[model samples]
Target: MTETQRPLLEVQGLCKQFPGVRALHQVNFDVIPGEVLALVGENGAGKSTLMKILAGVQPPDEGQILIDGQPVSLANVNQAMDQGIALIHQELNLAGNLSVAANIYLGREPKRFGLIDSRAIRSASAQHLQAVGLQVSPDTLVGDLSIGRQQMVEIAKALSIDTRILIMDEPTSSLSQGEVERLFDVVRSLRDRGVSIIYISHRLAEIEELADRVAVLRDGENAGLLEKDQITHDAMVSRMVGRDVSRFYQRTSTPPTIDSDATPILKVTDLVVPDHPQHKVSFEIHAGEIVGMAGLVGAGRTELLRCLFGVTPPVDGDIQIDGTYTPIHHPIDAIKAGLGLVPEDRKEQGLVIDFAVEPNVSLASLKAHAWLGIWIDRQREQVEAAEGIKDLRIKTPSADQIVRYLSGGNQQKVVLSKWLVMNPKLLLLDEPTRGIDIGAKEEIYRLMESLAESGMAILFVSSEMEEVISLSDRVLVMHEGHLTGQVSGGDINEASIMNLATGIQAVS
Candidate 1:
């Protein structure tokens, strides 16, 4: 950056260390005023650490943070806000039961005659909401709004506090396509008004579309920075991974050979998910095939998986494992029928983050290895953990390392290890590589390929069009709870899948 173009926010020699993990080390970056600075990184790359430090959620072990060329003491979140800085986390932090106006002015309401000025809050909230293009009434309950509208409320809340530097962390991860476009419009408008934004997202397409410049972090350090002209997908991925992952997802497993009368590994015959019971879905996966399910955020893909895994009961359906009708009303029944699921929110549903890596790996299989069906089998757990650590290349100092302390990629590996140990006939993966870095995603893809080659049936869901197209031998497109199209080989392009996903096409 030119000396005359002074940065609005600057970090130098920043460092953060956790037990068995160095989150950030000597990280340095600057954000110019009125510019949207995109931060890209792999899991455990220290992006979160740096963001936390900047927002004063945590103090760095060593470093200097400057605002407008002067060092500042941001010992707390309030102090950070006092300096016109605000953070919007990936999962929004908003009270659902409160009204929009009340939520916006929470903890700092305007007062008149020693009473809260509700009218003033509503008027100010309306202006802020308009600024972010939210048309909801100020008195609308926050809980009643859609996820996209709630996000706008978050931005409005930041504005209510007179925020100048807004940090958005994965803001679009939950939004629909239309919502994302509207958000981009608001971001550009904010930048035009001289509001500096630090944008964080794993969606490189978004970075390319919105960022004036891109800064990449790898292993808790600055990997590289790219100007607008240099902000291609390949450039961002290469920097984030410290290597070129141009061939990002390649399916190496050949198609499974099956006769017409062969019994498929998994068959869903007129399966009815409770979320979309009216739309009966039917599909089947052969023993060695990898099937990809692609759809929009509310397309019922996740619900289908939940039903198949017995997490959510289906309304009416027949699930056949090896051509035998199996009723999976509970997770144990699904497990006994040789099925496993790695949920999208691996942190909450898949792994016990506070527990050690070894325990997480053997969690699902512990019952099978237990002695007398009641006693814990310590020896089997230890052996399984050690093998998983080595086989999955989980980067941990030892088996006892807490899953929470591991990088996003390693945490995901632990979750996968849990299912792998069960040796299930059919595996279900929901957004398998959602929060991981490109390198880790590639590793997971390799594992999937290897598993498929070994005759394991795999069904996976992905929001990323690239991942769905490149990894799956067959793509099943879902729209509004309906399995609209099944594309394979020569017909599985983005346009075809999107046509079905958007309800413009159907299998019939």
Candidate 2:
């Protein structure tokens, strides 16, 4: 930042305290106009508290906020909005049953003849929507739109309010690759128009690509600040964790092949989901092997995992467990056949957020705690839940704490814990480490390594190229619902994976 150019927004000596936690500790930060400022840290590092204070959702215990070098008090969301500050939450805030136009101008509808001017609302909303590259009719229901399009509507809403500084929290956490690109385009365009943005995310690659400056927080304190040229991965990691993370993804140096005498835990022959009958997929995961599935967004990696787990039955296929043919027409059958699956969306598919941690940990193994097939064995349930909590190192005040109160990483661990209680011979993991920080990712990686060492077969799917290359013993690449090729050891690189994923290379 140059001397004459004052910051668009600045917070000095910010502090926040919860019941037993100091969320933020006299943190200081600033953002220049028309620049992308990335705020990064591990979970519970006070990023959310600072954001809430800035957005007027909560008050800081000690701080002064300045806009254009003038101090201002953000008493509430309305007051913050009056100062041209708007926050877009990770979980979108929108009335899905209402029309797009109604949602945009919800409380501040233009008046016409002492009544809501519906026609004017639609016309104004269309212009704002166009600004965000959304061309749909304003009268359409928000519920009918995809998640990506709904995000565009959110940006449109902010634009309609004449927002000068935008705070986006994990905006791309649930978006696909194409949708992320579209969102990035809109963000860059907004920056070009002199709109400042505070972007918070766990994805380091996004920070490297979009941030002009990076501010990292650790343990409720300001760790360090990096300008555009200094924001490298190692620098960010070193500051965030107070140590060098040079070997974050360190792997075992074992050979990819399993022992010749060992049996295959999972084997599939001519597997075909109903949506992709044209492709004949076959693979085998042997004991103690970590096999990764790599592909593009629509390459049917999840679909294949679903078929294998009996969430979606294969149209024509043969599944074998320990060299014996098995029929898995339902998830219960798969569970009985010694298989467990951790789905992609942990919140929606893998966990019941309303339930407590203890109950969620033992949900999948409830049958194991049945008393004479009538009553649940409470003592057994508690014992198992405690064991899972200890083994996973889940950060919770108590086992009775609601799962919803945990961080994203802890919630994912709860999901995995439920499956781990089953003692399945084969485990299927879909996007295991999505939306988690480096520390949590490393913990999960260590858990996977320990599991593999215990003679379990792990088949995981990851969209991240680096994760696949580092974690997989052998990787299976898919393209347009077909198994394109397989790579192991020295052949596992970005070029090889992309070529197979795009259908430029076939299995040979």
What is the C-alpha local distance difference test score of each model? 0.91, 0.89
Residue 100 miss distance in model 1 (angstroms): 2.3
Candidate 1 global lDDT: 0.91
- lDDT tens digits by residue: candidate 2, 2-59: 8546799999999987655577998999989899999998876788888988999999
TM-score of 2: 0.88
**Which residue pairs collide in model 2, if any?**
none
**TM-score (C-alpha) between model 1 and the true structure:** 0.96
